[model samples]
Every structure is written in structure tokens, then in C-alpha cells.
Target: MPKMLCRCGKVVGLGEIPSSNQWMIISDTMITDEDWDDNGLNMSDFYKKMDIVVKCPECKRLYIYSKGFGNEPEVYNLEE
Candidate 1:
């Protein structure tokens, strides 16, 4: 498992089953009729097209994995 360190000194990590802080982002343009069918969703293909996002519970910082988890995430902080 990979862990990310937030600027607020909070550590975030993913699990086998995503917790409350883990999410996947898929672009609206990336979705098509072909991606869905009677056989249900193509999980493997969907996973490949999606980007990972993790939120730090303590500081509420967002770590975006647009370039994959192997690289550093693009951090986003709450403005308010």
C-alpha cells in the first residue's frame, strides 16, 4: 500500500477496500454506452481510466493522482 503525507502533517493510505477517504474520479467524456452493457460494468477497464483521490481525515487535504499513484499527488486544500 502507498501512503501520502499531507502538508498538514497528516498521513493518508489506501486499503484493499477503500475507506471513507478514498475515491475514484472518472471524466464525463470518458464514459460511453460501450463501457456499459448487459454483462455489467467492466471493472478492469474502468479502473484503468479512473484517477485516484484520497482525502486526509485530520487536515482535509485532497491528494489527486492524475498521473498515477507512483508519482506525487497534486494537492488541494480547502479554501474555506
Candidate 2:
């Protein structure tokens, strides 16, 4: 599998972002798993929202993940 990355074309996976709610996604709601992709997908459907996306550089990994916001968690954990 590919790794996480930065918009600057840099890989950031295998390590943490050092904090939550500080990272970006590369693509919208089309991740590695059907379920994980669906979490953001369902939310988008119900709330008419789009999942934030990010692309991994070296691995070309695309992410449709987000951090939570107050009252509502912006991101949800995926099931592997």
C-alpha cells in the first residue's frame, strides 16, 4: 500500500503529523477501503459536504480524511 503525503509532493506517512486537525487530504471520498470512504461519503450526502482530500507524494497515496470540528468531528476513523 502507499503512504500519506503532503501537497508539496512529500510523504508524511509511517509517522504522525505530530498533532490532530492539522493535516490535509488529496482527494474526496475515494480511499483504499469501501467503508472508510463511505463514512465521509455518507456525511457528505446527508450534509451536502465534501470530504477534504490529500495526495501522498512518493507513494501517490490519496486521502479523503479530515479532522473533527467543534460539535461535529470533522474526521472519522476508518475500519481496516
Candidate 3:
């Protein structure tokens, strides 16, 4: 499991599976007819091209993955 420190000083992931905080984001344009065809689809390959987002359970802050900026996630704090 991958773990990272949240800006709120809470530890995200914490070596455990995230039931709700983690999500996979796929662009609508990325999906093709091949993906819908069971015989042609490869989930592993599809997942690699997707982006990930994790919400800090403690502070409700969002950590969004940016493909252009290397591995570090871009942080977004919730607005009141």
C-alpha cells in the first residue's frame, strides 16, 4: 500500500486499503470500442493510463495526480 502525509498532518492510506477515499479517473475520450469489446480489452493497460485521486479522510483535502508533474500529487484544499 502507498502512504503519503496529508497537508493537514494526517497520514493517508496508512498501509490499509481505502474504501472511499481513493478513486480512479478515466477520461471519456480514452475509452474506445476496443475497451468495450471484451476480447480486445486489457484492464491492466487501461489502468496505467488512468489518473488517481485520493481524498484525505481527516481533513477532506484532495490529492490529485498529475501526469505531467512526476509522482507528487497536486494538493487541493476544500473551500468553505
Candidate 4:
């Protein structure tokens, strides 16, 4: 597991390279190369499919999962 420290001095858990590649945390904003202009400057595509994903330092507060799109990890079951 890779350990990344947050600004608050907490060790963030990036346990496994996510079980599924289709899912990623939308941590920031980004535009892919294909969307760049002639000068290589990225053309705006905020509402498009391009995005920047990263591990949130605070998982408890910023975690999100898709119930139908990706396979959920098999950890301890959580009951409501």
C-alpha cells in the first residue's frame, strides 16, 4: 500500500490500485490531450468526460462510490 501524508499529518490509505479501473475519485479538474488547442493549451471541457482523479486525504468526508457501475470491494459488510 502507498502511504501519502495529508496536510493535517494523517496517513491516507491508498490501499490497492482501485479494484476497478472504470471507477476513479474525481479529486480535481483536468482536460485530456485530445481536447487541447493548437498551442497545446487545453480547451475548456468542464461538462465533458475529462476529469482529474486523485486520492482524497480525508476519506471519511469525501468518499464516493457508484452502486451500479463498478464492482464493489469485498471487505467487511456494513449494515445499516
Candidate 2: which stretches are off by over 4 Å? 1-48, 66-80
Candidate 1 lDDT (Cα, 0 to 1) = 0.81
Over 1-80, each residue of candidate 3 has an lDDT whose tens digit, in order, gives: 36777888988773556447777788899888777877857778987888877889998987778462258887789788
Q: Rank the models by lDDT, top first.
A: 1, 3, 2, 4
Give the per-residue lDDT of model 2 (tens digit) for 1-80: 13443554575543444423234443455444774656555644533333344444444444554442213223233344
lDDT leader: 1
Per-residue lDDT of 51 in model 4: 30
The best-first sequence of candidates by TM-score reads 1, 3, 4, 2
Task: Tell me, by TM-score, which candidate is best.
Answer: 1
Error of 2 at 29 (Å): 13
Per-residue lDDT of candidate 1, residues 1-55 (tens digit): 4566678887766654757778899999988877765368868878899988888
- Judged by lDDT relative to the true structure, which candidate is superior, 3 or 4? 3
Q: Rate the local accuracy (lDDT) of all candidates.
A: 0.81, 0.42, 0.76, 0.38
Pairs of residues at least 3 apart in sequence or in different chains that clash in candidate 1:
none
Which model is ahead, 1 or 3, in terms of TM-score? 1
* Error at 3, model 3, angstroms: 1.5
* Per-model C-alpha RMSD: 1.9, 13.0, 2.8, 12.1
- What shift in Å separates residue 78 of candidate 1 from its native position after superposition? 0.6
* Candidate 3 segments exceeding 4 Å error: 17-20, 68-70
Distance (Å) between predicted and true CA of 3, model 2?
13
Candidate 4 lDDT, 3-57, residue by residue in tens: 4444445566555665222234332444445445547543343323433232343
